[model samples]
Target: MSDKKYLVTGANSKLGKLVISFLLNEYQIKPSQLIATSRNPATLQSLADQGIETRAADYANKDSMVQAFKGVENLLLISMDAVGKRDELHTNAVQAAEEAGVKFIAYTSMPNPDASPVFFAFEHEATEKAIAQSRIPAWKILRNNWYFENLIDFYANVLHTKAWLTASGEGRHAQISRTDLALAAAAALVNSESGKETITLNGPESLTTSEMATLINQVLDISINVVHLSEEALEEQLESFQVPADAIIFATTMDRHLKENKSDGTSEAFEVLTGKKPQLFADWLQENKQSLKAISNA
Candidate 1:
């Protein structure tokens, strides 16, 4: 393991970039000991400039994945972006990692994968199953909850339109910042003792949709109407707003899960991993207020 290198897939993604940055800057992992991979090598020029090994790895290409995993000791499989193709892609990655004799794997997954009624949970469950079947020496699953950044889109629209509409009637979500999740992931990867663990990462608090709107209003100093609609009504509203049908369906399903109280906000796994309290929604908003204001103005 000491002679092998750390490999991070999807190193160019927002969350992936944060994880890699934390691994380098905070964890003090040498760039020479790290390999950052993405579908496009050009996008990872900064990492290459930092002396990190860069590689091209397409999730769809089994050979590319196998080559990328070569000589890798530990791997962080940032969940694939290709939604529908995730299961097969994840399987290929697992196979490649095993073939490369990877000692440990840390995968980013969704919260409550087994119990989540949301349509998106299928891929996570399948990936977890594949990892278990692989009999990998060690594994850590970071089951991240909804990101606070997800609210940027709806909150921006609400600030402009003066109205926030959702299909999640009385639904509550425990949304954490992606950066915090990334920190937790990096901490887990760096801690040699944290192996074969499955953790649910969420915010310090769970908030209802209406509560979220109130918080947004408080932070932005604006009044925005928060309206909850039936699933069908929300679908129609989203369609009218030009959202794609598949996205609308997925959103509605997630909203339904929230309404059913499927989310567990009791997880302190993030704090345990990172040795710090996760950032709150208000602080996250305050930090990004400038960008949010710009979007509102636009």
Candidate 2:
């Protein structure tokens, strides 16, 4: 592990960038020991400037990833965003990692992929299985909950109607910040602990839609009422809002998962990994108040 490097796939993604930053700034992972890979390696110029090797690795092209993964011992496989294409993309990545003889893997995954109600969660479960069956000596699956930043869409949508629609009923789910998730991921990639593990990184607490609306109300100084919808009604409403066909199923199923407490509860595994408690949603709301305010203004 000391002789090889830690590599992060999808170096250009939002979570990927933050994970790299945490590895560098917080964990002090030296540049010589760090590698960043992206489909467009040119976009990682800043990372290259920092002395971290930037390699071109396309998930669609297994050969590129297998080549880029050479000399890499630890891999942080950021979950890809191309919803419809992630299954094949992740399979390619896992195959490449194994071919490259990567020793350990820390994969970012959705919460409870094995039984998640999210429509596309099976992709993550498949990825986890691939990693487990691979030649890697150790693996960690970081099951990240929904990010606090998801409210960007929720807020934008609700401001137009002044009523937040949900099928989650009174279910409370913890929404973490990307930064906190990054810290936890960096720790998982670089920490001394090894062997197969699945850590659920979560926020400090769970809150219902009404509780979240109250916090948003306090910050944005606007009253946003929570409107409970049946699953069918939620689907119809999401369709009415022009949400894509695939996303409607994703959202509706996610709401069902939430209602069933699949994505709820706070986990301390994060504090164990990073020696710091995860951020509070209320605090995140305060820190990003300006952006949230601007959304309403926009």
Note the Cα lDDT for every prediction shown. 0.84, 0.87
TM-score of each: 0.94, 0.95
Model 1: weakest 10-residue lDDT segment is 150-159
List pairs with backbone clashes in candidate 2.
none
The segments of candidate 2 whose C-alpha lies over 4 angstroms from its true place after superposition are 1-3, 153-155
Q: For model 1, how does the per-residue alpha-carbon lDDT over 194-284 read when each residue is reduced to its tens digit?
A: 5588888989888988887788889988777978898889888888989888877777888888887676475488888888888988999
**lDDT top scorer:** 2
Model 2, 53-123: lDDT tens digits are 99999889999999999988899999888777787889899999999998889999988899988888888
Candidate 1's TM-score: 0.94
On a 0 to 100 scale, what is the lDDT of residue 143 in model 1?
86
Q: What local lDDT score does residue 132 receive in model 1, on the 0 to 100 scale?
A: 83
